[model samples]
Target: MLLLASVMAHYTWLAIDNLDDVSLQIQAEQIAENLQLTDGAPTLRLPENLQRAYDQSSGSYLYALIDSKRNILIASEDKARDVFSALSAEQLQRPESYFRLINGDGSGAPYYVLQKTLVGRPDLHVVVAQGHLHSDVYIDTLLTEFASHIGWTLPIILIGTLLFSVWTIRTSLRPIKDLSDRARMIRPETRGLRLPTSEVSDEMLPLIQAINTALDRFEKGFEVQRRFTANAAHELRTPLALLTARLDQLEESATAQQLASDIERMSRLVAQLLLVSRLENTTPNLEPGVDLNVVGETVVALMAPLAIAQNKAIALRRASAPVTVLAMHHQLEDAVRNLIENAISHTPPGTEVDVWIGEDGSLAVRDHGPGVPADLRERIFERFWRGRERSGGAGLGLAIVAETMRAHGGRVSVEDAHDGGAVFTLHLQLDKSAL
Candidate 1:
């Protein structure tokens, strides 16, 4: 736009200058037509209007007549005579009408000179001079005023365009923003849900549809996996019960006792795997609040007999005040029970396994036995993982605890206890505001 404006201004200036030149040519020709060469002394037969204009003595108009010998014959003003006298002989020899611009050196107003050779009088000529400062001032003034207005108008137009561009860009991207927000809400439970396609832009529709299709495949795969695990666990239950009954008939023997223990361990492993499958396929049930202190005390009590049978003791170090957490009762209890069972297994005979419920809603199970090595602490939570030196049970206890914690949006960590034993801590969401 600026380039276009500059081009327009340049052409307009040229047109104005050309028009002024045409006006000067016409004036000089009119002056030449009114000349009379009587007795070889040139005289101007001025019309009433032309005589009045030349004799007006205004700064804008002037006229001078020059003889064949290059001597000034008549001049409307002394300044005109002086300017004509100053022109070189060669400058005065033009065959056609011409105009010249002169600069004022502060002595008088700057002016333009128009000269024309007389038609019949061969050597006679007429020259018309006018003050440009008076005649051409309006044109220069108008151009400057117009250019100044353009200067202000262009910026306003550009700024308005800039603001409109920003609004347009943001408005155009609104659909993508909505798509991102909807994508974040998808979890395993909500995986079957689809993104709304009504308002999606045509340009983005293909990508969004591709993502929805991928999600469909993922949900189907997850359903197949969950069904397989649940069905296999269910099918094994009755046969395992019959096997237990058969083993019970001869369980008084050492071989029968060992078979029973192995069968029980296998049953626990199936239950743990089933729990993992179910937890992964669904969201945690957190409608009813459960107190971690109550859950911890219950799990400690349940594991107390097993600990005592191994010549180990289980104790609950409850918090001073109840620590309420946002978790389902059974799931919370399962997590705490697994931790206690793990502690008791690792603890030696005559040692105590401590279950501590913190006021901040964290549960810690400490065993006074060899602490888990730093490098193996995280690995111990993998399914079917056991320490290098450990034996006698399925290795899903810690893994079950980890999965249960995940279902509750909680965390489980193992660190060295003060007694040089391993301490497993379960960090839960503390519903202090509810309490």
Candidate 2:
């Protein structure tokens, strides 16, 4: 800022000096031209005709002439009475054609000197003197007075600009602040929250829409969880309560044993329910998560005793090799358990239930029993769906598997196996690194 101010001041001064120089040069030329008509040594005589003409004019120039050596020849008598000394030749040559000389007599008005070189006589110089260039001094005086008035007022303008900037920044961020507030209000208890979009800036509209979409998904999941809990309680609690009461009333006998069997069945149902409920909440806790092949084996171990009790042969076929995936432990186990259970229940006592892991991130559990009709195969995964004449189990196994697979970013389906048996296949997305 200081550099710029200095440049501005210097340029202004140069411009004003140039104006004076040009005026001085013009006056000097006119006077010299009139005086040199005799072609003698350069001289200046303010002729009467010229005097009268200039006297009526509205200006303050006093005409003069000078020799090339820079000596004054003629001066205005009114100017000479309060005259200042002659101007230096170098100063007279300024591009602006104006020169200032302070009066030695203390009475002369500040004056600008103008000199013009003679055309024919190289030794002659013509000049004029005019009133002090007063515009700059007048402006400076006005600013001095103006500064006194404005010194205390500048701080007010600065404070006003700062306050306005802060208000603008806050108002501009109001929508974002509101968005955060709405997000904070969303919870399991109040999951219906949707950020308002009516006043969103165009640049933030995508984020607003995405948040609303996420809220919609959250609401749906919460509803599903509520329904699952209610239905699971209704389905399992009744049989268990009845079985427990019967056990309490019975004595030791075949009838008592039958009650125990019923209790066991009820316990199995409750266990199945626990598996499904866990599945609903399971998600990968880490990136590049556990492999499904390992999950399938763990499930096979857990349910092997039940299969053996039913006189069903359970086996892993063809090196069900490592099936890599992104999965949470309990969720993948749920999907595997459902398929293995389906295989065990549907197969003949002697026929093997084969769980196969495929090369393409797929798992299949096949049972060599009467297969599902093609029409019903797709519906097998629907909650509580049971085939005609299907029995001995609640119809939730396949549905639970489907739900678990879907939650883990995968899917489950049923189709005919190579051996004309029903095969349930669960497929899950694998991380690229796992593959």
Candidate 3:
């Protein structure tokens, strides 16, 4: 737009200059036609208007008639001398009629000089000059007025176009945002649902269809995995129960004790794997408010006997007020129990494991044992991944805790305690009040 305005300005200036020059040319020719030759000497036969224009002292028009031998025949006062002196000697010697722009009267002001020799009197020349200062002022004034108008109009047009573009772009992208919102709502159970393509653009349809195809493949794969895990876990339970019964009937010897421990470990792993499979296939019930303080106390109580058996003490701390969170009671209990058991398993003999429940609906379990390394903290939550120094029942304790927390829109994080052991914190959104 600026470039366009610049072009317009330049062309307007050229056009005005061309028109003024042509008008000056016509005026010069008219003056030449009015000249009368008598006895081979040129005499001016001025029109009424021309005579009046020459009589003014501050007139912009000036003319002169010079004959052979450089004698002036008729001139407008001393104006003729100013024109003659303003020209170069070579310019004065020219016989052809031509227009020249030059500064005359020694004033440094530009004038248009039209010099011509008479038709029959070749040696007799007539020179006409007009001040260009007023014409220049007129052109400048016109451009200034044009620029002022364009300055306001162009910005308004640009601003309107910018606003229109923003609205159009935002409106055009709304369908993509809707598609993303729908994708976010898709979970294992909701995987059957598909994204709507009715509002999609032709340019984006291919990509959207490809995503839906991938989702279909993922849903089929996930269903197969869920079924296999459920079946394997279910199949292991019968033999595990039979083995436990056999171990119980013959358990007074060292071999029997070792076998019992192995059985217990296998049993716990089977239970955790089943829980993970269930969690993967279905969303947890979140319609109930469970007091985290109660959950923490219950888990501590359940693990107290095991900690005592290992020569370690389990302690509980609770806030004055109940810390209620949006979660299913059994699922929340399972998560808290896993954290307590994990702490008891890691702590050394004679050391205490602490379970803290806060009014902010948060729970923490800390063990007085070797803290996890910084790099391994996050990896501990992955299923079947354990620290090199750790011994556990298939490393599913923290994984179950992590999955449970995720189901409740909560998070579990492990950090080093100030007193040198590892502390695992569970952060959950507090249920302010039950509906």
Candidate 4:
């Protein structure tokens, strides 16, 4: 807009200047036409209107008649006479017709002067000059009005346009933002989750549909994997139970005891596989509040015999007050049981594994063995990711504990124990209703 205004002002100025020049040229030609050669001496004849217009003492218009010898024959005013007399010899010898802008009468006001020689009497020259103060004032007033109008309106127009553009962009992208939020809710346990297509624009629809299709394939593959794990564990349970019965009948030998231990580990692995399948296929109901102290005590009691057999001991340290948390009962108990079993297996023969329940709905299992390495702590809870010190059992125990905590919206972490061992902690959401 500013550029447009500048261009318009420039053209306006040029147009006004051209019009003034033309008017000056026509006036000079009229004065020249009135020049008559009477008795071989040129004389200017002017009409009444032209004579009256130039005769004013302070008029903006003036005219003069001069001869080829640079002598003024007649002038409308003394200022015009002075202007003609002061011209340089070279200026007086200009072409037959010419125009010039000059500061005449030494008054700092500009004049448009047109000089023309008579067609028949070349010896006589007619000069018309108009003062430019009034015209300049008019042009300046016009430009000032235009600039003032634009200055006030342009900023308002720009601010309104900017605000409108922001609103339009945000409104147009609202559906995509909603789609992003919905995509974040998708997980392996959350089946049939897809971005809704109803409000999405056509440009984004194809990408959203493609993502949903990929999720469909992934969910189907995950379902198949879950079914296979569940079925395989179910199929192994009966044979393992029958084999245990048969082995008990021919037991009481060194080789038989080692084989029994191996069978127990395999049974535990099968149970964990079944648990993993169950956890993947469905979300556990964690609305029920369970006492963390009770769960810890029960798991400690169940695993005490195994700890004693391994020449280690297991003990439960209950909280001063009941530490209740939101959880599924069986799932929480199984998670604590895995932690206890893990602690007993890892700790030294003479050391004791402690299951501590905190008043803040937290439970920790500490073992007096080489703590998990700092880099491997997070990976230790991944499915089948046994580190260099792989325990005899399949690496599903810690993974199950992690899955259980995730189902309950809880957290599990392993950190260095103060007494130089590993401490595995479960941080669960406290049940305010139970409190």
Q: Highest lDDT: give the candidate number.
A: 4
- Residue 63, model 1, lDDT: 75
If scored against the real structure, what TM-score would every candidate get?
Answer: 0.64, 0.46, 0.66, 0.70
Q: Which tens-of-lDDT digit does each residue in 233-343 have in candidate 4?
A: 999999999889999999499989988988898899899999888778766688656888888878888889999998998888889988878988888888888888888
Candidate 1 has what TM-score? 0.64
lDDT of 2 by residue, 366-392 (tens): 898888898887787877677845556
Q: In what order do the candidates fall by TM-score, top score first? A: 4, 3, 1, 2
Each model's backbone clash number: 0, 4, 0, 0
Give all candidates' CA lDDT scores. Answer: 0.77, 0.69, 0.79, 0.81
- For candidate 2, list the clashing residue pairs, or say none: 18-96, 21-96, 21-97, 21-98
The digit string of per-residue lDDT tens for model 3 on 135-174 reads: 6666785667567755567777788878989999999999
Q: Could you tell me which residue pairs clash in candidate 3?
A: none
The per-residue C-alpha lDDT of model 3 at residue 145 equals 59
> For candidate 2, which ten residues in a row score worst on lDDT?
77-86
lDDT, candidate 3, at 382? 91
- Candidate 3 regions exceeding 4 Å error are 1-152, 165-167, 177-194, 248-254
- What's model 1's lDDT at 65? 81
> Model 2 segments beyond 4 Å from truth?
1-254, 281-289, 318-321
Better of 1 and 4 by lDDT: 4
> Candidate 1 has which clashing residue pairs, if any?
none
Which ranking of candidates, highest lDDT first? 4, 3, 1, 2
Superposed Cα deviation of residue 251, candidate 2 (Å): 4.7
